[model samples]
Target chain A: GAGVSQSPRYKVAKRGQDVALRCDPISGHVSLFWYQQALGQGPEFLTYFQNEAQLDKSGLPSDRFFAERPEGSVSTLKIQRTQQEDSAVYLCASSFRTGRDGYTFGSGTRLTVV
Target chain B: AQRVTQPEKLLSVFKGAPVELKCNYSYSGSPELFWYVQYSRQRLQLLLRHISRESIKGFTADLNKGETSFHLKKPFAQEEDSAMYYCARSAGGYNKLIFGAGTRLAVHP
Candidate 1:
């Protein structure tokens, strides 16, 4: 792909429902990151991965938010029992090296929980 | 705690006017700063980084460790430059970026 791709550009989920967002990063990128952007706010870090290893999950808001990059190419972000506060845009970025190089961001998934 | 602050929520200017979006960060150690831009209905993209000291679309940002600021500036604003701008800092270890709330720039013709 020419750039990072994310699935389900928009999603509407009822409170307590579960939603899954997918990200396919640039082929062979070494680092993948997930971020959440609230309305009128900047994107906040959610988690990070180096290759297939989950190097950092400290940014995940809660146990309800889980992200995995099993193969290092594609990743998924899952939010269980979604709450209204969870409504926001989820963005995925990939970099060829550690972030000093720069990151390419996906279109993002806008999730609305009602 | 590491944090980025963009004080202005919106900045309006006439085309050809000078523009500056303010940003400040609080981090324990030396940090790398960057400016990201988002156009209407488009994905977010990198505009410039302090380390690069390069200008893109006539925009430049310089990291000021003395004042803890990284402000984006342009000599002449363009109508096409209307977009949302974010200031971010790279965290030390994991390299995750901490972003400011964002500033919306509106350039009118």
Candidate 2:
């Protein structure tokens, strides 16, 4: 892809239903990050992957939230037993170098849990 | 804890008028500050970072350590500048960025 690509631009889930969102970062980008953005609020960090290793998951709201970047190029954000609070825009971003502000963001997956 | 603050939720300005969007932060150690913007139905993109002192699209922001402020300023505002702006901060060694609540700027022609 020319840029970061996120799947299922909009998602509708029933409460307690599991859902998976996918993100394809820019080719060869070393750093990948996931963020959650509520209405009228800025994006909040959820997890970060420096390659195939998930270095940071401290921002995950709960144990139900899980993310993985097994091969380092494509990543998945899985939410088990989805709750109403999980409704938000899940954003994916990739950067060429670590600790740098140069990042490109995807269109984001707007998840709506009913 | 590191936090970024964008006091105004919305700001309106006339074309060719000066525009300044205030940003403040609170972090224990040295922090890197950044500004991101999003236009209508578009993805968020980085505008600039404090690490680079150069201006972009006629906008420039300087990091003031003592005051813990990174205010973005432009001498002349254009209607094309209307968008939502966000302030972000990250502590050294941590690649995670904490963003502020964001401000929506409206430049009228």
Name the best candidate (by DockQ). Answer: 1
lDDT of 2 by residue, A7-64 (tens): 9999999999999999999999999999999999999999999999998999999999
How accurate locally is residue A44 in candidate 1, as Cα lDDT from 0 to 100? 94
User: Residue-wise lDDT of candidate 1 within A13-98, one digit each (tens)?
Assistant: 99999999999999988999999999999999998999989888888988999999988899999999999999999999999888
**Root-mean-square deviation (CA) per prediction:** 0.8, 1.0
Score every model by TM-score: 0.98, 0.97
Question: Candidate 1: where are CA atoms >4 Å away?
Answer: none
Off by over 4 Å in 2: none
Q: After superposition, how far is residue B48 of candidate 1 from its true place, in Å?
A: 0.5
Q: What does candidate 2's lDDT look like per residue over B32-105, in tens digits?
A: 88999999999999999989887999999999999999999999999999999999987546567889999999
Residue range B1-109, candidate 1, lDDT tens digits:
8999999999999999999999999956878899999999999999999888999999988888999999999999999999999999999575789999999999999
**Can you give the DockQ of every candidate in the order shown?**
0.85, 0.78
